[model samples]
Target: MKDRATVVCVRDNRILLVARERSRWALPGGRICRDETPNEAALRELSEETTLAPIELTYLFQFTGFNTLHHVFFADVAHHARVQPSNEIAKCRWFVPVKIATLSASIPTREIVELFFRYIRTLESDNVHRISQQAERVSL
Candidate 1:
């Protein structure tokens, strides 16, 4: 099985996506080199494909595809960051999570975004639950 690193770069509630000349849109990432760590590959791939360096990368989770193990990372980039598409990437664009379903992107791209959205919702709910629990304890 192959190992790959994918970066989900976010800015202003939008996600960064890249496309090759005739390929479907996808997250900025590539297969890990023999001597490179997953994190290193993700950073390199993001920069190489989009020319947008990540402020910082946070490992969110991982998933196994048919032939690849994907290591996913999240980065919050500045909205002003320049995105110069390289040879490997013909174009770059940003999309809100809700609008992603309308794009002709790769399956993994859609799945990743949906999963990320669910994760954020879960976190929000958990925080709310925690706060409510604390309030109840205080009242009791």
Candidate 2:
């Protein structure tokens, strides 16, 4: 199976997506090249497709598809930054989380977004638990 790394870049509660000519919209990513780690591939693809680099990236999740294994990451970008598509990309746009379901996106794009939200929720819950434990320690 091919290995790929995708970045769900978030800005103002929206995610970045790219579409190639006559293709459905998808996340900015591509197949991992030889001798490259997933994180390295992700950063490279993000820049190649969108001409915008991530402020930071956090590993979100991974899943195996029929012919590919996807390693997804979360990135935060500034809202004011413009996404200039490279030749391989036809167009790039940002969509709010709630609007993603209505877009003409590939199935993998939809699945990846769902996973991204789930990962964010998990992070929030973990942070809350850590805070509560810290509070209990202070009370002792």
Candidate 3:
């Protein structure tokens, strides 16, 4: 399986998706280069395809698709960041997560997006629990 670096750029509850000519909407990323790490590939592909440098990028997880192993990364970008489609990208847009189901997207893209949102929800839940515990301890 080919190893690819996929980036998830989310802002204001919307995820950025890019499309090539006559292709389905997908995240901005591409295959890992021979001399570069996954992190490097993620950033490079994001910049080449979207022309937007993320404020921060973090490794998220690895996903196995039918013929590719995706090294997923999360990118933090400003809410007002403008994206210009570059290189092989034909168009770029931000879409609400709930609207993804209605769009024509690659299976891996759809699955990765769902997974990312679920992961975020889990993180938020954990933070709330931790805060609640801290409050209880302080009151005691």
Point to the candidate with the largest TM-score. Answer: 3
**Local accuracy of candidate 3 as per-residue lDDT tens digits, 21-120:** 9999998899998999999999999999999998999998999999999999999987778899999999999999989988999999999999998998
Q: What is the TM-score (0 to 1) of candidate 2?
A: 0.91
Regions of model 1 farther than 4 Å from truth:
138-140
TM-scores across all candidates? 0.90, 0.91, 0.97
Q: Write the number of the candidate with greater TM-score, choosing between 1 and 3.
A: 3
Output the better candidate (1/3) by lDDT: 3
What tens digits encode model 1's per-residue C-alpha lDDT throughout 71-93?
99997776688888985899999
Which sequence of candidate numbers ranks them by TM-score, best first? 3, 2, 1
Instruction: Go through the candidates in order and give the C-alpha RMSD of each one to the true structure.
Output: 1.6, 1.5, 0.8
Among residues 3 or more apart in sequence or in different chains, the pairs in candidate 2 whose N, CA or C atoms overlap within 3 Å are none
Model 3 deviation from the true structure expressed as Cα RMSD, one decimal place? 0.8
Model 2, 1-140: lDDT tens per residue? 89999888888778889999999999999999999999999989999999987778878789777788999888776667788999699899889987888988988889889888887899899999999999999999
What is residue 90's positional error in candidate 2, in angstroms?
1.2
Instruction: Note the Cα lDDT for every prediction shown.
Output: 0.88, 0.88, 0.94
- Show the lowest summed lDDT stretch of 10 residues, model 1: 75-84
lDDT of 2 at 74: 80
Best by lDDT: 3
